[model samples]
Target: MAEKYRVGIIGRTDRGNYGHGLDSVWREIDRAQVIAVADDDERGRWSARSRTGAERAYSDYREMLEQEQLDIVAVAPRWMNEHKDMMLAAAEHGCHIYTEKPFCRDLTEADEIVAACEMRHLKLAIAHQTRWTPTLDVVKREISKGLIGRVLEIRGRGKEDARRGGGEDLWVLGSHVLDLMRVFGGDPQTCYATVLENGEPVTGSHVREGNEGIGPLAGDAINAMYTLPEGATGYFGSHRGTAGDPSRFGIQVFGSEGVVEFLTGHLAPCHVLRDSSWSPGRSRKEWVPISSNGVGKPETLPRTGLHGGNVLAVNDLIDCIGNPEQQPKCSMYDARWTVEMIAGVFESHRTGGPVTLPLKQRENPLTLL
Candidate 1:
């Protein structure tokens, strides 16, 4: 019989909690076993232990890490503030990690997490579940096959709800879109952005503490442009109270010959429009459905939603652990790039001009304002 990988889960009761069922997904993986769980809240700790079928529970995650011989640790909290410490602790214990998104508050934290994992040769995967979806594979394959000829531009938007619109939306939801932009548009080279609050340019006075422990935030409307390699340009925008009926929150890839559109879910619908004119009315083109198998084919994956996506991600993480050469599709480095993109928007807005990638300013740009 193969050795079962021992897993530990970390969560906080009402604070972020076990994000998107990260703890429960381990129950579905046959090759892994949940050995312990940690949550500061006594009630939440026991609940997590029962939920994950963990043998033990701890109030402090650091103690759990020190006691358990864990092979993998799921830093399940959705909050960004807990991510850096949890990840570093896991790395120090020689355990691989799978954590929720909005990687960290700033590039400095991200760099520290990256360094710690690198030092330990630990594999860390972020919960950008959409990247693990089979639909993305089809999208990539179609783009490569000239279904969308010579990709020219990529655009993404966030769920601009009443509360989490603009800068907040960019950090919380736009991270997913930015990851997709990099997948299709290549590495971003430079960015120029504008941030506004009730029609006025955001200034230092506008900065305030954001939700989810995201440091200093400003702006209720944001528009950003990025330059990618090979002449591909990227754009991300969000405005408070401007979300449409169907929600204008997804990605669109425009090519010389056509365009592809996809929403932000593991099984989100994907469509391709083939038209040289790039306008459906002018060219009489219709958008065609794309599936995991291929363009217009049926999806073969039995599972769906976050559970399904986490299954795929965990399986890949296990494989990467053994292989050492492979990396999770949504690896830690990809998460870092997503953070950089989010930071670049504010950084560019602060400077009133374009800012180069691998941003020199490691702190939150709102603070510099």
Candidate 2:
């Protein structure tokens, strides 16, 4: 019998909680066991302990880390402010980490986390579940086979609800889109963006504390463009109250020969239009559905939903732990690049021009405004 990896979970209850079922998902992984849980809130701690079937619960995550001999730590908070500390603590304890997204508050925090993990040779995976979806592999294969010849552009957008539109949407939901952008379009070379608040450009006075501890934020509408590899361009935009009927919140990869569109999820809907004209009206082509197996094939993965995605991510982390050469589909470096992309939007807006990649400013750009 193989050794079962002992996992410790960290949550903050009403404050970000066990992000997208990060705690309970461990129950589905037979190779791992949830040994303990930590949450500052008393009720949340006990409730988490029950939910995860953890053997113990602690009020302080630091205390939990010190006492428990954990093989893995789930930094389950959706909130970004606590991510840096929680991740650092996990690394210090020599435990691998699987955490929620929007990696951290800024590039500086992201850099620190990456350095720590790299120093300890710890494998860290972020929950950019879309990257782990089998459909993504099919999409990539199709793109490579010239189904979408010479990918010219990739466009993505957020949910753009009235509340979390623009900057907030960019940070929260945009992270997923940005990650996919890199997957297809390659590393961004430069970003130029415009941020607006009430039909006008955002200024320092407009900046305020964002929800879920995202630090200073401004703008209710954002239009950003990135220069991707091989002359491919990427665009991400969101506006307050502008979401569509079915929610126009996904990525569309446009190529010289055709286009591929996909939503965000482990089993996200994907379609391919094999038309060189790039228009259904001109070519009279049909959009073909894609599944986990291939275009027009049925999904083969036994599990689905966010829970299923967590299982895939956790399994990848375990695999990477056993094989040091492999990295998770949503590796820590990939998560940090998403942060840099989000920061570039603000940095570009602040400078009123294009900002280069690997942003020189590591702090929140809104603060500098």
TM-score of each: 0.97, 0.98
Give the per-residue lDDT of model 1 (tens digit) for 1-369: 238899999999888899887899998888899999999999999989988899999999999999999999999988888899999999999999999888999999999999999898889899988998989988998798899889888999999999999999999999999999998888899999999999999999999998987878989999999999999999999998888789878899999999899888788888899987889998888999998888878777774788888888898888888877788899999999999999999999999999999899999888888
Root mean square deviation (Cα) for candidate 2: 1.3
lDDT at position 297, candidate 2 = 81
Q: What's the lDDT for all of these models?
A: 0.91, 0.92
Steric clash pairs (candidate 1):
none
Residue 176 of candidate 1: its Cα lDDT?
A: 90
The true-versus-predicted C-alpha distance at residue 273 of model 1, in Å, is 0.7
**Can you write out model 2's per-residue Cα lDDT over 264-355, one digit (the tens) per residue?**
98897889998988899978899999998898787776757888888889998898999888888899999999999999999999999999
